[model samples]
Target: MTNTQLIFKKRPIGVPDANTWSIEKNPIPEPKEGEVLIQQHYVSLDPAMRGWMNEGKSYIEPIKIDDVMRAGSIGKVIKANNHPKYKVGDCLTGWGGVQQYVATTAENWYKVDDTLAPMPMYLGTLGMPGMTAYFGILEVGKIKSGDTVLISGAAGAVGSVVGQIAKLKGCTVVGIAGGKDKCDYMINELGFDDAIDYKSENVMLALRTKCPKGIDVFFDNVGGDILDAALVHLRMHARVVICGAISQYNATTRVKGPSNYLSLLVNRATMQGMVVLDYAKDYGNAAAEMGKWLAEGKLKSKEDVYEGIENFQSTYNRLFTGEKNGKLVLKVL
Candidate 1:
């Protein structure tokens, strides 16, 4: 049978619009020795996908021109050839490009069970977003009890979890998002103590009112001016966790530099950047911990699922538009 995929037809000079992608259909390749054929269920749509599209120096190589665009996906094995311990029906998560079917070795894929949680969660909390929030908060942010934590893009997958994780650790949480609906969801649904509508309010003033004692940990997702605002109100020894820069992803010009970095010196604070893959070797340990939290009701995972691979480009655009909430995924099945 033929399988469809999206390819990086060209290296976009700036933020990718609909014109940057091309679709193609090809026969599903037979698995070689020690490989398995997987039918993709859901594919993760992350803001980081924007970075991978550009030709530049990064922690990982940029997606090559005309290659199937790289992405993380959850799939179920439909054929297992020369591989032990995996059955034809086993669901797994891996770096399965934007395709309907994937044939790869099981070396890096993790087995997933729907009985434990929903299939999409495998791409959210139990997957990269969860790990990003987990390590970025506990390890990089170094959060403590009663600490006032502020998160930009607080309604998003990673930011949402970051706020909840900080809350679980006994801190007061404030979320900053784009609109009133997102703000309401952060404060009402996610239990964040307050939320600032960055689109409608002066951020510095909002920070002053909401985080009076100053932000103890700033879990930053949307960088740029929001970062500058958070920096000015940071507490002494505050940790700014650079999880992502969703705001600057689509800029036609060079990203604006954070102007308030000197505040780190005045407050004796530190800022740290993290890529979730840096901790891939220890993902099992972190997932296990997050799983326990999920079971205990201390942490919640939300997914923004879009159906069909045909809509990949438009669905991807949602990340930059601030229209998507939670961990965005495209349901391919």
Candidate 2:
């Protein structure tokens, strides 16, 4: 059978756009010894993908030219051989790349139950983004009750979750989003204490006004100006969780690092980077707690799923456009 795939053709200097990848059809390969075959149903698009296109060192290896694009995907096992854990018909999530079918070991994959939530959700809130938010805030941020917390890119997948989880931890949650719609959703729908419109208002001044006592924890998804804004409001002993830097993902030039390095010394605050894979073992525990909140109507998630694997280029570009309101995913089936 023919299997469609998006091949990484060229790395972009700026936004990848449509020319960055080439889509083609190839014969589906059968599962070999110690491998499983998955007919992928959905794939996740994220800002981190842009970084993966560039050559260099990172938490993960870069996607080289002529290779299928890397992505987090969910699908059902159609074939399995010499695999102890996964069985045929079992639904799973893994690094399936951007393709219609994946044949790989079960090591990077995990079986997920459809009864828990939609399969696509595992790629979003109940998956990497959820785990990132849980560990980044509770472990790295070291959140405490009544602490003032601020988050940039507050409506996106990871940042939205960080704000909600901080609220659950008894912090006064404040969000910084692009427009009034996102700001309104953060405050009205998600129960954020307040939200700053970074597009229309001076982010630094707005953060100062919203967090008068100073920010105890800052979850930064967008770097550059937003990171600078958050640094200006850091309280003593503040902890900054570096979840992502979406603002610099599409820059043709060098990434702009935060210029407020002195804030760390002045406030005795700690700024550290976090990668979700570091807490892979604790995903079940975090997902359980998030599940309870979800069942109790406390934790909420929004997913923006686009259809057709053929539209992968446009779907992927949405991550940098701020056009997608929540976790952007693509449905291949």
Candidate 3:
């Protein structure tokens, strides 16, 4: 049978828009030794995908021209051969690319319980973004009870979860998002103490007014000026967790570095970077806790699911538009 695939055409200068990809209908390759064939149900669309399309030194290799565009996906195993512990009909998550079928080794694949959450949730809160928020906040940010936590991009997947998790930890949570609806969801729905509509008002002023004692932990997703604003309002020994820089992802020029980094010295604050893959061994335990919170209704996971891989370019670009409310996923099946 033939499988539809989105191939990386050329390295993107900024965003991976219409010119970056080409579609192909190719024969599905049979699984080799220690491999399983996946009938992918959902493909994860993350801001990190834009970074992967560029050629540079990073945590992982760049997507080469003519190769299948790399993406995370959850799917059912339609066939398996030469692999122990994996069977047909097992739902799993892996870097399956933007394709209808994937034949890959079990090394990167993890079995997911579709019963606990929907299939797409596995690619969202129950998946990488959830793990990212878990480790980035609790571990790297060093959050404690009664501390004030400020999050940028608070309505997006990782940021939304970060705010909810901070609230659950007894921290006074504040969020900065784009519009009225996003800010409303962060405050009224997600239980954040304050919400800033960056599109309407000045973020630094809003943060200063909301967090008069200063920010104890800043969980930054959208960087650039927002990161600078956080730096300006840091409390003594504040932790600045650099989880992502979505604001600078599509920059044509060099990424704008924070100008207020000197505040870190004044506050004796610590700024650290976190890569989720570093905590791979601890995912199961973290997922268990997050799952319990989800079950108990203390934590919420939201997904913005799209349909069809053929519209992959526009769907991927939608992330930068600030229109999506949660984790963005594309239904491939």
Evaluated with TM-score, which candidate comes out highest?
A: 3
Best of the candidates, lDDT: 3
lDDT of 1 by residue, 1-333 (tens): 789998888777676766688888999989988889999988999999989988879989999999899999988999989787687999899899899998888788899887899988989999999899989999899999999999998898888999988888999999999999999988878788999999999999989999999999999998999999999999999999998898888788989889999999999999999999888988999888889999998787888889887899889888888888778999987
Candidate 2 lDDT trough over 10 residues, lowest sum: 313-322
lDDT for residue 285 in candidate 1, whole number 0-100: 93
Native-to-model Cα distance after best TM-score fit, residue 297 in candidate 1, in Å: 2.3
Q: Which stretches of candidate 3 lie over 4 Å from their true place?
A: none
> CA lDDT of 122 in candidate 2?
91
Write candidate 2's Cα lDDT for 1-333 as tens digits.
789999999998887867788889999989999899999999999888989999999999999999999999999999998788888899999899899999998687878887878987898889898889889999999999999999988899998899999998899999998889999999999999999988899988887789999999999889998899789889999999998998998888888988997999999999999999999988889988988888888989999999987899888777776888789999986
Model 1, which residues run further than 4 Å from truth? none
Q: List the residue pairs that clash in candidate 2.
A: none
Task: List runs of model 2 lying over 4 Å from the truth.
Answer: none
State the displacement of the C-alpha of residue 310, model 2, in Å, after optimal TM-score superposition: 1.6
lDDT of all predictions = 0.90, 0.90, 0.91
User: What TM-score would every model get versus the actual structure?
Assistant: 0.97, 0.97, 0.98
Error of 3 at 68 (Å): 0.7
Q: lDDT tens string, model 3, 81-141?
A: 9678799989999899999999888687899889879998888888999999999999998
Q: List the residue pairs that clash in candidate 1.
A: none
Worst 10 residues of 3 by lDDT: 10-19
